[model samples]
Target: MRDCCLLFQGGTQLPSSCLRDEDVVALFEGRLPVSVNVLAHHHAARCAACRTLLVTLAHGDALPSDSVPLALLPLEQGRRCSRRPSVPDATWTPPAVLDGFRLERLLGRGGMGAVYLAQDARGDRRVALKVCVALQPDERALASFATEARAIARIQHPNVVTMERVGEVDGRPYLVYEYVDGKSLAELRPPLPWPRVLDIAVGLAAGLRAAHQCGVLHRDLKPGNAILEPDGTVKLIDFGLATFVGSGGTAPRGVREVVGTPRYMAPEIRMGESATARSDLYALGLLVFELCTGRLPPVRRGACAAFKPEAGRGPAALLTEWLPGIDPGFAAVIACCLAEDPSERFAQADVLCAVLEHVRRLVAFQRTSRVFPTPWMGAGFPPPKDEGILAGHNVF
Candidate 1:
């Protein structure tokens, strides 16, 4: 091992430990740790994957014009790497079938894999199948799929997407989940009516409760991960980033990585702390705020740490400020979820679920009695300069 004290050594030797995907990302974003910054550059110079990764990341950044998509380049290497630019290839078609499921079409894709809507002929049902199609799947990517399969396999809930099967297709791990026949919460145009928002929030809480009861904590709980059926049934999907609840639980895939979606991550998680059920609730609070206002909470440096919620100064007050004439009781519910302090947030998912249900009933009753507090409040939050932040997706 090299000496940690070599503050500015012009090191030429490669570190025995290879740089991870996160390390590469941090290095590109200028967030890499100083101790290994030199080693990362040296390793990237020698490693084909890392060099290609830098190019891809650069293409995604300011130097995008420099990128020559794999499709445009050539088919010399058929491997799909996350670092590659995503260029539309009209010629590319879905494989007819994989294992037994008939691939209908591509639903979505990520750095490591693609999810397809498929037909489960034997079961006479439809399923969403996630297949790891990475050209040369890395250990972390494979471990993610395996961990997701195991995590979802252990929990069964109406609100949470149900897993049908787990197996490998051509050496790549694939997971089959019961299809929701609908779009994600994100797909449903934001600033949905307040009542509808409450319904989705309640369903999400129930799904989270189920996961928590099974000792699973969804480290990432953004709207995109929550699918809504035609009838508005919220089905929480994507357990790839989930972990067993509690401090003593084993790390995900036995690898501890703080690679959560920054916008949805709780303050503690952002500062490199273990995730908890409360952290998931914090994300829920952000989702609810977006649903109500069609925008996310501002992304300020050390936001949560700075905003210590006092009695009247909690998240509710801000919600009321942004959305005039909103129900105070309902605003308070979301405020509790957004509390900067974990201890101040809901102690359990079940508790939050019950509180939301109560609010829903009260709103319905008030509406029937013609005493509703607000007229389906969704009037505030002007469009942000960057539309990406429109749907409450302010990344830190």
Candidate 2:
């Protein structure tokens, strides 16, 4: 019982303990030779006096340096006589899916969930995380919410914000989404350029087309839900209120005011009629109007109002100059979308996408004679030297 410590002391001697020299080496190897590792096996085999000394060394009250040649181990083992890394306080253990994602800040909150900005582990990429709270809702509402999550998970398009993963922790749902880097169209204070407006319109049309192809409809199509990513990409989000075109609360089938915001709501949606694909188109047209003119289409007192020439002047004027020879076509398309009769609008999102592509070609044709300055260059931005917009501004 006295042999263990004596065997380890001064680099060699049998101690008044039961642990053999071979047992001591085995314990050291088990700990990977880390300093101050508690000799559990040796203690279990030792007498009371030897056990007490081992306990003191394990607790760090007594140094094992004089008894053992631990200094020959790694620098870290020699420096700290501790069992584990020094953790000052208990920290919140993040969910497994969010292991290395550093939560930056809460972006916004809605009825279904909250959005947060976080850094992805791999490349430190910025991403948006939508975490759903298990709030007290009726069974029907909860089912609908889950359905929305599943529907969005099935969609894939460059213009639609991609759902990375869906995680459930403690009965709460969390959605990981690709981060869109630009401000919302509604948040764009001034009127946007015709080209930029068309760009967003084309992207939105493409995204909606994909959703429609899969038998889905974005009941709520508003500027607020569209974002321009930093890479000049557009993405549409907030599908929590969306539903299958003919299923759930989608118009022509259900009675609830299921999707869409008031300002951009189609006449059908507002009238308690079934929201159709055309209803989504109508909302998209309204968003286009907002982007081009920075004005909301006026709705009368408790009813859809007539397009008053005076009130619609801002957007109308911009459209006039921007459209030129192509203005009538654009106006006609928008008017058709906003028609009181859903049947009068474009039958499918693909048709709308084609129409928008044509508009882009028209813009390119119209700008052939004169060069329009880059939109970002208007506010004292450096112009392309090769493009000859500046003098001696060598950007290369």
* TM-score leader: 1
Error of 2 at 11 (Å): 97
lDDT of each: 0.66, 0.55
lDDT of 1 by residue, 1-396 (tens): 111111223644433334443344456556556777777666445434446556645543211111212222222245222233333232223367888889988898765678998997677788999988776666766888987888898888889999988988667888988888888887878777777888999999999999988888878788778899988899998888777755443233432345456556677664456677878888898888888888865443332332444445556777777778666666777877776666666767887887678777778778889876442243232222111111121210
After superposition, the stretches of candidate 1 with alpha carbons farther than 4 Å from their true spots are 1-94, 246-256, 303-313, 371-396
Q: What global local distance difference test value does model 2 have?
A: 0.55
Which residue runs of candidate 2 sit more than 4 Å off their true CA positions?
1-100, 121-124, 134-141, 246-252, 300-326, 369-396
Instruction: Give TM per candidate.
Output: 0.70, 0.61
Q: What's model 2's lDDT at 253?
A: 59
